[model samples]
Target: MKRFFRLPALGLAFTLLFSTAAQALTPDQCRDLLQQYYIDDIPQTVLDQETIQQMLEALGDPYTQYFTPEEYKLFTSSMEDTVLVGVGGTFSLTEGGLLTERVFEGSAADKGGLQVGDIVTHADGKPLSGLTLDEAGQLLRGEEGSSITLTYLREGKKHTAKLTRTAFLVPTVYSQLVDGHIGYLDCDTYGVDTLTHFVDDMTAFSGLATSWIVDLRDNPGGDYYASMGTVGCFAGEDALSYLLDNQGKYSAYRTAVESRTMYPALVLTNENSASAAELFASSIRDTGTGILLGERTYGKGVAQSVLDQTTLPDYFPDGDAIKITSYRFYSPGGATNDTVGVIPHLLLDDDLADEAALLLSTPAPAGDTTGYLRVDLEWRWYIDLDQALSPEYQEAFVALLEALPDQVKVWQGTGGADGWTQTSAAALAEAHGLTDYTRRGFTDSADSPYRASIDLLATYGILQGTGDGTFQPETPLTRAQLCALLAQALNCKMPSGESQFTDVDMNAWYGPAVNALASMGLVNGVGGGRFDPDAPVSHEQFVTIMGRLAQRLSMVMDLAWQNRPDTAGDSFVGWSDWAAEEAWLLAEGQTGLLGNSINLLWDLPQDIDPDAVTTREEAAALTCTLLQWVGILPELS
Candidate 1:
């Protein structure tokens, strides 16, 4: 949808001078052509430039391009078997607008006497107004060893600091103790030397590290093999990534051959932690080597292919570099990590925790000495294990779910004109040619809020509407639809084949859950030769599914299930204090928009009509949402 237009000088040259009368190339022919072009662009003299261009157009690659003379250095620089060096300073623009936060943990700013609260108004004589953090970054960054002057306001006084930038090989490994002897590591980038660096830092600090925090925040990416092996340090020599070709065949990849387990790790990341960061985090967590902290990483799990690097120097005119998505990667557990970032174990605020840090800093010992050390034992480390479980996942889902009651106001239980009983469940029967059937399900469980829950759940999956615009709740749930809902609510293992069920095929949308529900003991075959995967499920079946689902989710919900000392007096808003570590509360908000429904005293997910015949579209919405909720799918593209 986004189009970028250059001068089109090259476009004209490509069309007339290079493109040839096109012919439909077979997939194999396409691969061969690309390999040939990449390995060597020079072709038979009979093969005109136009023919080559036309042939190339047959293949699709968005990141694909031919390098120019000027881009040679850039190409070689990125693809080189070395790390990219930069001036190491993390900068920030203040909320009030003129001041900037320049942090030089150990960078040029530190050596230049730039303090933490310094307000940078200008960079190299250029005003810093209206410039975003990235723009400011660009002005601050220059070639290694270059000098830039920064004008700053320090404590209501103006000052200037000129600092010469130094080439910094971004060390992939960082370690320090945070929160109760937990080691915090900021491995921002993974390169060929990453594994070595990680092992060295960890091994050196093994004596003190009870647990660790690996910060992958803001890491773009580097070599795949290098990054995989880096985290594999904790997971041992295990499968880290799997490559699936266009044919859907999976090829597994393991880290460098080794076997070792270090301290328990907790990875910290944000939306900016990307590519190798996501890949590496998922590998470690899926393999049970660590818990993920912070937020869901920026997922970049696709593998890129480099073409023309081995040859075609003359055509490239620049140093050869071409990286395109060779394929997408799956986690060691076989879950697709592309687009959907690795979901975090905890979500943290984007802003730096400066307020908390400053508040904890001890006041200078009786002042008299202006330049005194403030040794605040409390400020010495930052990390809270209890904070990790709250306001992050479970309750967030519940909150979102609770917000939906208003959205479904039209659907009433007894309104024959259009009700919860007429829309969501009966749609399955109508679509699958079961017109005469009545919906055979209801419940008086707890507030008898069954119909209300149906309205909420159905609408969230976009299922709570009928052909005549009805919401019929009395309809019996269909087997296929039940599978669909189950598939969405839990991690539906993508099937390799139409499991032992002869009735279902890979094309069946619900085939994924046929084996899953069966394995979970929530479903059983009806009589001989009847998987009844498509037949209407009974109310009895619904209760069974609900109980099993409750049991299954109990594993994930344990941390969310808090002890409420006073159940009678507890209300949703007031429960946060009692449910200090509320993961389930957040997850409830995510699933079906139950966000505001946190005040419930019941373990409600246990009571929903699991046998309800969720529609295909509804199943898609549900499964996709739950996939994101459970960390199996991406919440953002």
Candidate 2:
């Protein structure tokens, strides 16, 4: 959600001269608000209120309250601004079948080979059969430059198209009278002309609704004046809130006496509701004017002010002035709500009845973790990376490098390390101190194609043959087995951390590796907070893991490499982008250590077999490959 101050330049307090006769704040209110109430310290009696306001603005607070002259103009201009960008296609998914109504010329759709009248069966790979057009549109829409895949049906065969979303205009406010007697205001954000549109809506629903519901879910705050104007519509001339400063001083802000509502009202909110929306809901409830429904409001008690550009040299001489949290706001009842948010009168649990019952019941204390995970567990993994890579691998890698320079830097140094000369498998094994070793179970297989790779793995303590002299080469590798092998190949230590997945027992053989991999951000559980450790590892999942391993090694080795640039971050780059690069490496005939390493894992297929369940032999070969790329083995001849 985009949060910004919405008031115009004319409303700026700083624009009015410090000694101007026409002022909104009284002498005491001005002195207290500027000198005593602000987060910073100020002189008792030295300069004018305008200069005092500028000094108060210098203090960094959550609410950047004071806007400089130039900044005030920009703040007001945003309210009247229009023009946005979005994905470049028109869609309609009715019972008649999902139809592409139109595809904009020269847009992402046209560039990606999408044509008008193409029947889209699925959006982002999910079937569009049961979804409303709006839902499907929402699925297709995303931030500019972010892509979504559409599994579209053209003629009789199925084809896929990926498109990057661009900007497009979308309304911020939606209001109507629902069920004949209920005025329903579905506000997406508080923007310029929002209050005007809202007032028009209210007048239209004046003789209609007996009750009202102002829905503020997913609202990223906008103009404070717009929100305050909204509050005035319900709270009347009452003291809406008090702003408190560091010096124990308070300033009262009253609502417009003429705009109060007399009807019973309910404000709908959710976890996404924040900033000005929180203030609006809390003020309504505090003034005994309305009841709050849904979850607790997002706790964003601090406000920001837009400072003028002229004051930039005074405090921060580099850029234009900004909003800071000068004062902490209090409810009309005198309760400070900063980190702690306004509690709802009714708790919504996806239904009104369930919410009513839950709200009435004694609330359980909140836990450290959000019980629900946000991943869609049911997504199909049939879309091949090679399909996207085969045609646009170069462009994809360039994009990947741009988006994730640090990860790419690690990958770029794969065979570029010093003292990392190409060596034979036997020589690489000897270099790693693997001397006293003998084949136990596979002694009879002298001509086995993978004997060298298998022996090298065993020598390095990366794998052990099956018991009773039987190396079960044909057995499928389970999730747990892969975790163990990868951990050993990476030379990672057994983790002391507890398991986060419900199915991963702490005492299990793979627990340490699983936990360690997760802690290192190399793996994530299959949703529902459960790690299906025993499930057979699929070809796609293994490659995904291998890609992560390579990137992790890249980052580690890059750090130790002399004069390497600092590019580390909190999270690893996404696997899809890196995996696409890996696909390119396989598609194009790249050789030496990197090529030999990839070949050891899987024979390069035209379209990588993402669905095929990999065998134990394959896992072992891949582990050997991992060792080779990290400079633990020589390039394959």
lDDT of 2: 0.53
- In terms of TM-score, how similar is model 1 to the real structure? 0.48
lDDT per residue, candidate 1, 1-637, as tens digits?
Answer: 0011111222343443322322232334334545543322424332332443344454434334433333434443342322322344445566422343323245677678876556788888897878776676678767878899988787778888888886444344545544435555666556666777777767766666655667676666667787787766777776557775544345778787453445556566677777778788777767766555455566566666654535543333334334445566666755655444665433333232212222112222231322221211111122121221234422322222222232221111332322222223244334434433343222321233244344434333324234454544444557876766665444344556557566766577667677667755667777664587767754334434443343233222222333313332233332233232231333242223544543221224444333344333333333333343444632221
TM-score of 2: 0.37
Model 2 ranges off by over 4 Å:
1-82, 85-169, 310-319, 350-637
Please list the C-alpha lDDT of all candidates, in the order they appear: 0.48, 0.53
Cα displacement (angstroms), candidate 2, residue 565, comes to 64
Tell me how far the alpha carbon of residue 604 in candidate 2 is from the true structure, in angstroms, after superposition.
Answer: 82
Best by TM-score: 1
User: Could you tell me every candidate's TM-score relative to the true structure?
Assistant: 0.48, 0.37
Q: At residue 481, what lDDT does model 2 achieve?
A: 79
